[model samples]
Target: MVHLIKTQSSSAKSRMGPASLNPDLPAVAGLGSFEKLNGFFNAIYDGPTEDPPWHSALNLLCETLHAKHVTLILKPPSPVSTGILVNTDAVAHDATEAYQNHFFTLDPFVGLPEGQVVTPEELVGDKVWKQSTLYREYLKPLDVKFLIGADIQTADGIECRFRVSRGGDIPFSADDIALCRLLLPHMRRALQLHSRLDGLETERQLFAGAVNSMQLGTISLAHNGAVIDLNPEARRILAEKDGIQISNNVLCTDNRREGHELQRLIKEALSGSAGKKGPGLVEALALTRPSGRSSLGILVKEIPPSPWTVNRQRAAAVIFIRDPEASVAETSQKIVQQLFGLTRIEAAMALSLANGSTIEETAENLGLKKNTARTYLRFIFNKTGVTRQTMLVRKLLGSVASLG
Candidate 1:
């Protein structure tokens, strides 16, 4: 299970990491290139965000090194099925480019020593050279003689190597390897962030798709108070021209007051001093229209970032209407288990009432007397906050349509 990280406020002493985690991580302590990276992490919660920008970091390294070809391998030890993102000033990434098909498989110097800078031979020995005869034959024509490689160990010590090969008879000097070492740690961490961000983006898209398909009005806003995503129902509720218009994350709502209030909450969340990205909560927020109509029983919670790490960006607040007039709660006991913390008997009585069953019929179904069924109905109303059977049907409609 993944636990949500609580970031320290201005009033509290800051914690770099959890007691159980690695204390030496520079990113946690806000040091070095890590400081800039940490700032970027904070920026994610400040507003809507996309995948971690990878090529920019590579561009920084490329400008510093003035290398011919800078390839960031996305796969690990598996040569057969690994992704390679090659950023070269000389070449464009045409769809038909067969780079991944040829170079990675032909490259022989892999399995480098972890946490240490090295040259080609240092990583792959005489025995490897003997085995990679085909690779040598292929390299001779290109005159590629030098490779500066090193294994970048991650925060959890997950080891992966990065190598830059120069196309010349001249060998790579010690200075070149040293520079690679200097940039390796930053590149590795950036790559990890990129991976995590990409994964989160995918999940967000899928989840958004699911939400939009549902009847519930779901809206997810970033810390910056910008509309991140909204379900079809929500879009219908807020959309001005033919549903949604995307200009500065703006929406025309019948209820401008509610819209503005939500925006304020988002702004407050963005301004939070927490190093982690999340919306903690809103204080007594009231969503209303100019007509004085309001969305009631709005429940909000800060959803943590993805449990998986590698590309790290946080998710947004998940808000729902607890006692929805627009939706019906499902009769499924499993949903009852999740929502109201009700027992099986209580859930059954609620469902029966929602189905328009009288006390005698409910008793017949439950193998009980009318008085016993009436007793269960009383408990259900108390648990679900329904005053009568008609109100219970409204709860059933609004609540049952989703098990989110």
Candidate 2:
């Protein structure tokens, strides 16, 4: 049986926890009920970082509170800004849109302090709530009644509000308020974790896009040489399958000698032996295709362990492949000069690199000395805030400042 006992604290008078909802009803919420809640907490973290599985977790919360519908609403600090309101039920889109567009100001529970659990009657008495336009015109038509709200958090002018509502006359009981209070901390923590994970996913996408734009193929491998991730360029290279291909989810080249060397480096990198070789030690090899296309230059390097990757087993080493035969897109020299503040010669050098020309080759094609080309490259790098040719290429290709 659930009991409510009063106890005095050093700073306050005697306070009591919530009493049972109904003494007449049997206690359905036993140890097993709490076990289910624990499961919900664990399940919230086990999914794609971009799109979290919140709907299922909300369903579990609804079951615990015996609520008809649980809705999450976010209100920006400014009235003109658009915010989000999502409901556990699918049919409330029209009602929710109306609330966002018109009735949010009339909402009795808006602007509440964080962690304050409240009910409709507490905000406005039963008579006043019934007479309000929000209740009479908007909520009554939708058959929504009896709300319990708690402000989970407010950060950077964004307020996170969570509420549970019941319909058809009966109001939320003391038990419902207590249950909401109990689960509020876990819910708030979960939302914080979700925000952090989403930020990480965004950064990962930006880095991947920059790498792909440089026309470089990047592949991440696990300790066992299993493929973990491949950028867009890597996917294209693998699709050609002239020399490099995925065999049984592991990276493999057509030539036995080079494949064996590649596997050895991967293993050595994963085992942390790569650092013993020397500083900035990277293994390089060439993949020669039988069709006589340009050879693919592959470089394998160890990724140092970090606290951010303590739980991930497959983020140990990365492979970068440069294909000499692949066609390069021509970048506009005028756009390059405007974007990077480059002189005409420097812009020419940048565009030549964008078109897959080495410094010597570009110097020969432009009828300039190699030292002149090198000097121009340094100036371009300084203007673009990069210290290396690879970074310069990445910046030029990834930037949309010159694009139509």
For each candidate, give its TM-score against the true structure.
0.47, 0.74
What C-alpha lDDT, on a 0 to 100 scale, does residue 345 get in candidate 1? 82
Q: What are the per-residue Cα lDDT tens digits for candidate 1 across 282-319?
A: 45444443444434434344544556634323335544
Cα lDDT tens digits for candidate 2, 1-404: 12223333433221221222232222224213435545656644442232324676666667766677887764432378546665675436777777777788787766665787886667777788788888788767777777778887735333578878777777766655656666667767667776676688899988777667667889998877789989888999998998899989988789999889888888888888988999966668888997899889988888888766655665788989988877554456787888889998888888788767899999999899999888888888889999988898788767863241
> Lowest summed lDDT over 10 consecutive residues: which window, candidate 1?
22-31
Q: Candidate 1 vs. truth: CA RMSD?
A: 14.7
Listing every candidate in turn, what is its Cα RMSD in Å to the true structure after a full C-alpha superposition?
14.7, 7.7
Off by over 4 Å in 2: 1-33, 43-53, 74-81, 154-158, 307-312, 327-337, 340-404
The C-alpha local distance difference test score for the whole of candidate 2 amounts to 0.72
